[model samples]
Target: MASSFSDMGDNLDSLICSVCLQIYKEPVALPCGHSFCRVCIEKCWESREEDCVCPNCREVFPQKPKLKKNVAFAYVVENIVNVKKGGAGGTGGTESHCDVCNGEAAKRCVPCEILCCEQHLKPHQQKEHKLVDPGVKMEELRCTQHGKPIQLYCKDDGRLMCLMCMGGQHQDHKVVAVEIAHGELKDVLAAKYPHVSQSMESVASQLQQVQEEEEQTENSSRDAEDRLEEKRRLVCQFVNESVDLMKSEIKKRKMEKLSLLGKQREKLEKHMESLREGKSTMDKAFQELEAVSFLQDSKDLLKRLETMSHFKSMKMTPLPVLDFSKEEKNLDRLITLNKNFLEKIQKGPEEHPEKVDLDQNNLRRLYGRSPSLDPNSAHRHIKISQDLRTATRTCTKSQYPEHPDRFLYDPQVVSCESFSSGCHYWEVDVRSSSCWDIGICLNSMRRIGVESGLGENPESWCLEKHYNKYSAYHNKQKTDLSVPGDPERFGFLLDCEAGELTCFGDSRVLHVFRGNFMDPVKPAIAVYYDDDSVHFVHLVK
Candidate 1:
């Protein structure tokens, strides 16, 4: 019966799974006592959530049955498969049945797939064998290359080697017994892990510190930009306010001067009227024949003379005086302005400094300077006054020596003094000129064709006026200013540090330019049309 049960026949076919077509792996018995491999049934009924039916018996389970291995069936299958494969016996035991002797065996021949007892498994045997021990799981102890038990470990190759392999290819390789190699490797790993861990921790700490420093640097950059922008805002506000105050001052001076002159004219007009009345009276008396009429008119003329004499005692308006240097009120006003400016600087925007009026015509003299025109750089068509204070476009050319700086086409002249630092301002008196260009230009640009035109090249910046229209030019880009402006004067303000050039049309801001400028910017005047004139007002500081 035992032999029949162990036979590889129809009865053993029941152990095979229908799904895998292989011997049942972890066979389980369902509630209906129908058996199936656990993996095979799970895969087949995966779509069913509950109440699964057995594939073999078709018996429904209320809930998908929890599976447990069939221990008795597992034992039976193992014994049957083992016996058919020519193993020891149908029972579970450590001893093996030797194929040659049919007796208890001590070792199994790996390549031959047979068992061998102690006598046949002698040390001098040529066959490969491993000790059989059913009490413990068998570990891989044999080398694949030689089909012999692993006796040594080759450290260089990191592999196990048999006696024959070690003596041949592994002869020079560093090797030791397997037990010693395992123990040494473990000890080395234990010794180096602490140092590696410490190094990793140090690197992590330094990385954290570097990240923190980068954040701080970014914060500092943001703060610096904010502060810089704030400073620029304050500076711009102060400069604009100053221009406004200067404009107000110019208007005030003009009014006061005109008022004083008007008063004197009124007094003189009354005196003239009285004299005319006396002349009329004497003429009438002289016409009325002879000494009788003349004697009669003499009394009336004396009375008129007496009335005119009363006006003579009042002195003429003192030349309508408003000298900045001599006037006590103007000096006091300037002192107050300087004090306010200093206070604004010390206390910042919170000071809210009130605008202080200054001389309009002398605005540049206070904040900057207007240098004299260079006689050598003047155009032949430009006639400089004898005082070198005014320039006019002359019809006939003078026999002036030809200088390299002389204008070739565009009748332009440049200043002798150039400023590279600090704020500078100047006034240009266009004075009803039909066409003109007033600006600051580089000394290096001129004496040829279009280059002589102010703001035609990269080196020049100018405001152009022609035929009752206005336009500003810089780097060859023109901007129309719809503002016709007072045909008399314009102001220019240059802030070298701030890289700003501002043009004012009759005290109102006309155009502004932002850019870096080369050192020594000179004021320039260009006359492009007939009868056009431009002059730089002497800004006496």
Candidate 2:
């Protein structure tokens, strides 16, 4: 009866799943003839993208196969488990069963695809068959083509092969014993992994530090720019306030000096009038009175004459006047020193003295413009002065006949003169205007559309100011400018041959516009707000 139970237990072991090492629950067979629990096989192939392979045999399928439950196998497994639970003496087992008899397997013959007991292992030992502990796949231990035990490892193919395969298809391939190949590969990986892991950690730490430093640098740059802007605002305010204070002081001193001079002049005039009256009395007595009266009048006259003589005898020196020669010298020296320092700062590090001289010559010479505004070209809201040197923005329209060249949409005015060739230079006094555009435009630019505004169309390039901010504009594109000082006088240099138009503020380059000039260009100005005006400054040569 014990022997009968052992045989049944050995048969039951054959039904156990290799993946879970337990009796199959809801067994599903793959196309490779390998069976596993349905849930277990699905989980094993969950991460695969293209094809799934059978875990037991490593056979790849081109596509996912549909799972089919083995109902008969599931029923058999369930019944066997129930019977084993009901029985008093269970079937005991320590290892796999022998292929020949109902006995516990002691050794496995890989090439023969068999598990043997000590009783059945004698034949394999005598024949020198390779024996190993059980629980290995029979297919993996032998070559598939030759059906012989794997004895060699082919280095070129990175696969295991039998002696027959080595002598046939793998005859010229580099080969070694399977044991040697496995030991060497294991040693190589073990030696290299530590260094590679250390390098990766070091690189990761460096990258994190670099990212932190980059953020810090950007923050510092932003802070510096903010500080610079604040300083610029404060400096400009200081200068304007100082100038106003100085003007007030000069007026107060002049009033005090004039008051002293007026008082001294009134006293001198009163003394002269008294002396003239005394002289007239003496003359009337001498000419019209008798001898006695004349003698009495002479005595009084003599007293008066004595008083006049005393006044005449008093030493009279020039009155002390206010003098500013010493103050004026000191002021001139201060101005010269500050001007030199400002020039140096504006030039920056890249510009040299020679470059400054050349730039100055370019700006001052080359047919400088003192061109007057053309009344015919002025906008209705723009008031051109009689001299035509200034154009002003007005709230009311001017009473003038409409002309074809007039600017209808904007408060703009153009010069009477135009230049088609040669270098030209001009200056615009923009001190009175808070928002204005000073530039040159082609003579053919549109005069009736919104785009007719200076710097709004392709035919114009302008240095524009909105309140305190400045920008260079061309064809509706704006480039912001950083002008250091309050520049009331703006200089423009146009080199027709070089195709460049340069704007200057405080003798420093503000912006440059480049273009190919093929048409005559006239000076143009745009003013916004009532009372705003721009004057064409006449620069000397």
Clashes of 1: 0
lDDT (Cα, tens digit) per residue for candidate 2, span 467-500: 7899999999999999997898998877776688
How well is each residue in 361-392 modelled by candidate 1, as lDDT tens digits? 45555575756777788888887766565667
- The pairs that clash in candidate 2 are none
C-alpha displacement of 16 in model 2, angstroms? 99
> Which candidate wins on lDDT?
2
lDDT of 1 at 187: 65
Q: Which whole-number lDDT from 0 to 100 does residue 516 have in model 1?
A: 69
Reference-based TM-score, model 2: 0.34
Model 2: residues >4 Å from true position, as ranges? Answer: 1-358
lDDT on C-alpha atoms for all candidate structures: 0.71, 0.79
Identify the runs in model 1 with alpha carbons over 4 angstroms from their true place.
Answer: 1-365
TM-score to native of every candidate shown: 0.34, 0.34
Worst 10 residues of 2 by lDDT: 85-94
